[model samples]
Target: MLNPLSLVSPPALRAALRDRLTFRAKLTAAFTALFFCAGAALLIFVTVLARQGTMEQFARITMDHTGGPTAPQPTSSTSLAPVSPPGPDRAASTPGPGPAASTEPWQKAEDARLARVEVNNRLQETAVRQMVVWSAVGLAVMAVLSGAMGWWLAGRALRPVRKVILAARRMSEENLHERLQLTGPQDELRELGDTYDTMLDRLERSFTSQRRFVANASHELRTPLAAQRTSIEVGLADPLPAHLIPVREDLLITNREAEHLIAALLLLARSDRGLDETEDTDLAELTRQAADELSSLAAERTVVTTVHTTPLSVNGDPVLLKHLASNLVRNAIQYNHPQGTVTVRIDDARRLTVTNTGPRIDPTRVDSLFEPFRRLDRDRTAVHGHGLGLSIVRSIATAHGGTVTAAPVPAGGLRIEVRLPTTR
Candidate 1:
């Protein structure tokens, strides 16, 4: 014999399986099941109650009387006493056959039995019909209501997910700054949105940094190229020997500037790549070397340079770290005034400080000191330093798991500090 359940058509079976997996379908199915079960239970209870009532009524009828019916009681004083059989034999004067045996009593008993059976059958039929019709109607109504409610509830629960999807679709690199910012009581969806927003925040910062770096690089390169082109064009225009020597000198100066700019750009790129090699090196030693390297430049500019060292070791790329130290010292010496002091200090706490007596800087411009190609008023107008000095310092320090901070000195110039984790 075939299993009745397995006899379902293929299309119907597939649809049922598909519906079972979906949230909406599952929710609706759950509601329908509950409604159906409840309705069936109520119907069964009602049917049982009705059946019990009918049985009780039949039982009452069956047990109510003594046998079928009691013998008829005397109706009045006239029939209170028996007839006395009408004087045994009233002779020939009495009716001939004494009224053939009466059959009325037997007929009445038969009629009563048939009437009871008919009433019972009619009552049962009525109850069964009513139950079938009303239960079906109630079930149909409840199924519809349950399905609608389930659909509505499911939509409400998924509303936040829809918002997240829409927001994600509208996202791009240019609009990474946009946040879901979903507001509600803490739940899984809210947590997800908050996490997504945090990720976007990180992406936006990274993009902004990259864009600024590229723009600064382009502007720095273009300025030198433009100057070089102008110098060459002017030099070629004046062919005289006297003018030619001066023009050649101008070309050399422009070429040197371009060279310095290119070197700075390359150093900046390397620093941005982060440390690819690590070694235990004394920061104090690097600081001393950097100071010695810039000592001549300092002297030529009438700036006195000094280095104070205490052995403090850190793990980082030696080249990048050396570059970091050199940039700081160079900036100090290049930006200092005549008779000014440049102090490079390496403390035992893994901190490097470079202080210089240069033109007093505006406090507001201190933060911008570490931005690529950004310089103070004097450095901006001066023909010398390209402004990647502090930026390179900051990048290298960060790559080595360190922090750099700078403050404008009250007595003129800048005080910069770099703190690195000590090698263990």
Candidate 2:
């Protein structure tokens, strides 16, 4: 058995109808039904009244023809005496079967019947007209009420969407912290709100990091610029006869610092944008060439270098890749111990590892080693360039969709691994 409550309720039916019909259409249908019913009832009432009137008129005419004095009368034959004519006074006093006499009772009865019928009919007609008018009026009132309700319901249903629109309109770059206060169960709108919030969070973090990087860059450049200015001012203001050589050397050092700063800045900017162009290049051949170029630098530090050759090919800017390999080998030789062995290994998988005997770095700071201006304590004395070698390496690797990692070896050295996607 179905529950009575499962039946379509009044509100449900009304809503379904409202969805299907427009306001004007519902009003038109209602008014048309009322008018048709009223017209039909009026027609029936008029027909009944006309029929009764015609019957009454027929009865009146029959009585008038039958009750005339010229009509024949029935006679009795048993009487012997002749009938005397009616005297004027007696005839005047007696009632004959004329129109007035024959029809008196019937006319009275018919008049009464007609009067009663007219009264009842008038009452009935009045009631029917009143009912139809009232019914139409009630329907009109209901239509007005329903219109008001529908408007209210439409407004309520769109309230949440309105709120979302307002929230979205208020968002901007400066006010990215603002978010929609959506209070509902999981839905498309809620999911949209969540995604929007997540995007804003990421953007905020990126902007914050960018701002910090700019500030740090400004500070780093200002130091070298100030030193250069001081050196120039001192050289111009006082040319001491005895300290002329030292002053020139100090100026040279300041100029070198400025040049280093500029180079580091350019490298960082290029890495951020990506390599200008890419071409097919042999990684192993490039590494061997860089090792040969850096052999003199390594020999001065007494670092014994060994290079393993393999045909490791990749698609990239050859110039940048050469610079990347040189930086890695140079850092290794510059930071290694006296007479330490520096090994460069290249495999068929385009994996290159550079290991050098050097003071081990703290594991916690290994990740930060690739950051610009970061340098290990052992390389502090090695000068003439900014601490951006590993930073450039990481950047080039990223541009080529590769990665680099540094770890302390068990044999008391640093092992740097460079992994590149092999061109198959």
Candidate 3:
């Protein structure tokens, strides 16, 4: 017959295990259970041994009380029975009765009963010992099974985490397009993967824009540089009449274009480095100064300019701020219709708005218009600029921790607002 203890199959036992219970926990629980069981067994064994020892001592005491084979004394001397002499020939021929024959029947019966009880007690103790040994063995087997099951469960529970780790490890700049496969409900790990993918998408877009900007800037710089070189080469190759000034004009144009490109590059570099020559200046005074400086250009365009002023103090580099304000005002006047109005307003709220009557800008392209080398007019005829004027304005405003926004006026033309944080 199969032992009941060994009837538990390994696979069936393993199937009963739970997940996330680690090996150490299982070990600790098993040892604790084993320690208690061992203690209980030891206690039972000691109690049984003690009871057996006590019973043995009691049996010896009873035997001593019975005075083994010793005869009882008379209560009084007259009551004693006189000894009878045996026949002389019979005494000589037969041996006297030994002490063993003098023992009482009850004494022997009690001794035999005690021996039988002792044998039965020994059998009971043997059965108890066997039970304790088997129980302990069963507990040890359970501990081993539990430890194996716990380790397997721990591994299974950590499987998802491991997959996430592997995915993260495989991620690189070259392979940022690769994404984690989220197959389950939106748990924390899945949420984390989603966020990571979102960030990577944004980074990829930024990188694409940066690459295009670099390519466009290089093309813009190359045009003027090539023109300057050609002008210099042509002027040196031939001596022209003094009044035939087309060459001089061409050289002048080339020089201006080169200077504009260099200046734009410098501004972009400085903006990137966070280099600003800052100081506290009156914005109203700055506006007046910019209007005066641009008066000649405005007159040439036949654009009437009006300046409304309020004292607004701000902390920033005066030259850069003037450049920013001048660019906006110039862009307005340059793009305005002949005999149109260009208005500059400075308010106590530290707001500067330059509004001009001009051709309306396409709403779709408004956001990209402020990017470097992005011209609103692709033909470059309606307006003359390095396409970096508004970009520089944005850069300088950002350096001063301000913002510049351009919006079309409800009535007509464009309204460019520069908002700065005021200083008391």
Candidate with maximal TM-score: 1
* Candidate 2 vs candidate 3, lDDT winner: 2
Candidate 3 C-alpha lDDT tens digits along 278-377: 6788878888898999999999989999999998888877878788888888878877788989999987666999998976677676777689877666
lDDT of 1 at 82: 44
At residue 76, candidate 1 shows an lDDT of: 89
Per-residue accuracy of model 2 over 192-250 as CA lDDT, tens digit each: 77777787788767866774685467567867777777767675565556657677767
Off by over 4 Å in 2: 1-242, 376-385
Clashing pairs for model 2 are none
Task: Give a tens-digit lDDT track for model 1, residues 1-424.
Answer: 9997689988999888886686656776787788888888888888788778887777567546424544334448647654655555653556535333334565576577657766776877797778778888988897788879877887787778878889888775446878899999999989989988898898888877885686578567867677777767775665557857786777767777776777777676666656667989877788788788888898899999888889888887888888899999998888888899988888766689999997778999899989988877865448487788898898788777788999999999999999998762
lDDT (0 to 1) per candidate: 0.79, 0.73, 0.72
Candidate 1 root-mean-square deviation in Å: 17.9
TM-score for candidate 3, residues paired by index: 0.46
The TM-score, computed over Cα atoms with residue i paired to residue i, of candidate 1 is 0.49
TM-score of each: 0.49, 0.47, 0.46
**Looking at model 1, which ten-residue stretch has the lowest summed lDDT?**
65-74
Candidate 3, residue 177: CA error in Å? 25
